[model samples]
Target: FIRLMAKPEKLGDLREPRAYLTTIANGLVSDHWRRQSVEQTYLDALTLYPTEHQPSEEQRALPIELLLQLNTLLQQMKPLIRSTFLLSQLDGLTYRQIADQLHVSERTVKSYMAQAMLHCLRLKNQTDN
Candidate 1:
C-alpha cells in the first residue's frame, strides 16, 4: 500500500483493484518465505562451526543479507549462465568440466562466466553508489 501510495501512477485506472492487490500480496508472501528460508539456511550453516568460532548475531546478519542479495541476483541470470557460474564457484568445476556437463564448448563456459561476473560487478556498482 505504501508503494502504491508513493507511486499512485502504478495504480492505473483503479479498475480490477482486487486483482492488483492480490498480486502484490502474493508477491510479498513469496518474498517473506524466501527470506525465512535463506535465514534458516544461514543459521544451519553456522551450527557447523565450533561455539567460539560462530559469528556474533550482529556479524551474522551481514552474510545472511548478502546471501539473500546473491540469491536474487542469480535468479535474474539466464539459466545456462547461472548453471555455469554455480558449477565453477559452488561445485568447484573447471570450465572444461562445466562444458562437458552442459554439452557446450569451454569457450561458451568462459563467455557465461564473463557475463555472470559482469552482471555481479554492475550490481555491486549500483549498490556502491
Candidate 2:
C-alpha cells in the first residue's frame, strides 16, 4: 500500500487504479531483486578466512618418518592411551586437563602418558637395527 502511494503510475479520471498499484508493486519487486543481486556480489568477493588449525588429507601424514614409525609401533596400545599420549605429548595438554577431558584421574592420566613414552622407547629400540 505504501509503495503504491509513493510511486503511483497513473492519474485519476477513472484511470485504472489497479494498473498504478501493479506498476508500483513491480517496481518494488525489481528493486528488491537488484538489492539481493548486489549483496550476493559483494559477499562473493569476501574471503572465507583461513582457520589456524585447518585439517586436511596431507596433514594426516607428516614427513617425520620416525614419528610415523613410532605411531604405528604404538598401535597395540588401547585407543584411550594413544589419544592421551597424542593430546598430552604432541598437543601439549596438561595431565590435569587430559584427565578432565578423558574423565580419568590425573594419576591415571600421568600413568598412561608414561606408558606411552615407554612404548616410544621400545619402538626406538626395535627400530635401531
Question: Considering every candidate listed, which one attains the maximal TM-score?
Answer: 1
Query: How many pairs collide in each candidate, listed in order?
Result: 0, 0
What's the lDDT for candidate 1? 0.94
lDDT of 1 at 11: 78
Q: Which stretches of candidate 1 lie over 4 Å from their true place?
A: 1-10, 13-15
Residue pairs whose backbone atoms clash in candidate 1: none
Model 2 clash tally, residue pairs = 0
Model 1 scores a TM of 0.82
lDDT digits (tens) for residues 1-129 of candidate 1: 787778889778578888888998998998899999999998998899999999999999899999999988998899999999999999999999999999999999999999999999999999999
Cα distance off (Å), candidate 2, residue 46: 26
Worst 10 residues of 2 by lDDT: 60-69
* lDDT, each prediction: 0.94, 0.70
